[model samples]
Target: MVLPVGRSFYVTTDYGRVKGFRYAADNGRPDAPVVVVQGGISGTGQLWRLDGSGWWQSLYDAFAETEDLQVISFDYLGGLGGSTTPEQPLTVEQHALAYLQALEKLGVDRIHGWVGGSFGGVLGLQAASLKQGPPIDRLTVIGAAHKPSIQSSLLRSFQQLLLQNCDCEQQGVVLARALAMLSYRNADEFERRFEHPDDALEYLLAQGERLLQRHGKQANKLFTHLTPILNDYHIDVRQITCPVQLVSFSSDTIAPPALVSELEALLPDCDSYVSIETPFGHDGFIKNVADYQTSLSQYLPQLAETHV
Candidate 1:
């Protein structure tokens, strides 16, 4: 079921256009404008995932089947998808500015939705509280923070350390998968996914081996990456005021559903929430795309009626 998927590209910033990715116009409706953002790390945009996170695929397969929707995505600075520009003092605000400039350059006036996962979700929050111009019409953020928790900060520190000292590709993947899977859920989801204790270890071992085989060696970029992530993590989310629709995986241990509770409490206006009780945890937000389409389809009409 190859649903209509569109081109992947990048928008030139003042720094110059680096390659990014987009998914646009499934089933022949180009006018319906939506944009997607990947998280803040150096990872490639998940227009299609060969590895761990398959959530983007689920999102597209669900939306592309319907007509009248246009979606786009991109890679952020310091990323493998970005140019090697010094980017002089990159911050979340700066990142949002780049995205704004791109939207302006593309002549996109307003958006039906601004969607992001992880770091992408941070920018979405920024747009909600935008002081510069018109706020985004709607926000859909899954597993993002207005601020990093203590554990999250510690993990970021460890990632930076790995990038600097060990620089082991295998270690990086091992750390990433371990940390990421842990935050995504508690013991419940893992148990379900593995079906047995020994199976879980086997699954994790297989997962780690495969990941290290590929992306384990991104330490060069990771070393260059740490500061920016830490900076973004410290941003004050109080500025975001736009209407929000939050999604979380009960299994997601990284950006736990509890974090969403904290964010919801802080938002100028409390909004909606949907939690997918899957073992998939943080990655589940991206991987379990089918569950989301059903969620979106049911909720969107309600959102329009209420917001409109």
Candidate 2:
């Protein structure tokens, strides 16, 4: 197995300790501009640890080679190897505080940019809006909104119900995750990938099995506790003063274009809104990273001058 190559440490926070990893840029500057890349709910801080076979390997390599750029990322406070399981439900503000405290511990007073999608994106927004956290210079949000839409909220509620009704928590998590996959992807992807009904059924079952193996029996409890926070995510956008770029996929159902548009109008300093066409739905942020990067490059000249 290819393991993550970096130093790992923990930082104390209001919620608990957060696990983080630091990747120094090869440009040989210790005081380099720092960029934070965060992933969705099912991910960890080790997301950028790319092997050659993974889709993200090229994207990781691209940033790793950027001059005077350092990347720092941490796992969510309640997930995997990060902090202990939440004793109570964690709000978006609490999640933001944990991330702020982690960076404070690392002596990061100002962030060059913060990139996140879905759950991570909303958390970034919440963090930037807070008066107590480190200042963010630039922000990139992909397929996320200030709060869950009515359709998305209803779907999550159903997933939660399914999780609570199962006899085995592991099985429940598997089912819930499978259902979430449907939301992450569009109908066109399913039609193209599966020729027959049996293939589709098999694929979903496999994905569920993988989740069960990765999360064990605690999967249901963890998601059950976290779902409400995701649904209730809200922040005062007027508080955000940094330039922001919002990217939404045309096919994304969870964080659709209309919701992203509403978020863009609310931001006091929104730089641009780029809508990309993709069949991957809400997961297009990862599925079409090359296109996403192309959109981001438009702001590169601006970022460079700001850092200089």
Candidate 2 backbone collisions, by pair: none
Alpha-carbon runs more than 4 Å astray in model 1: 1-4, 26-31, 37-43, 46-55, 82-89, 167-185, 191-219, 226-238, 298-308
lDDT of 1 by residue, 1-308 (tens): 22334366667876556555555433445545554445535355555553525335556544544445556666656654544444453667666777677766666677667767777787777766666533466677877767765666676666556545656656655655554445545676675666677887666656656655554454344445533364344555576666677787775545777888888888775457777877666676666666665655544542233223
Against the true structure, candidate 2 reaches a TM-score of 0.91
Question: Model 2, range 175-287, lDDT digits (tens) per residue?
Answer: 88888888889899999999997898788878888877876765554575566678887789889999999999999988999999999999999998889999999889788
Clashes, model 2:
0
- Lowest lDDT sum, 10 consecutive residues, model 1, at 299-308
In model 2, the runs with Cα more than 4 Å from the true position are 1-4, 53-58, 300-308
What lDDT is reached at residue 205 by model 2? Answer: 71
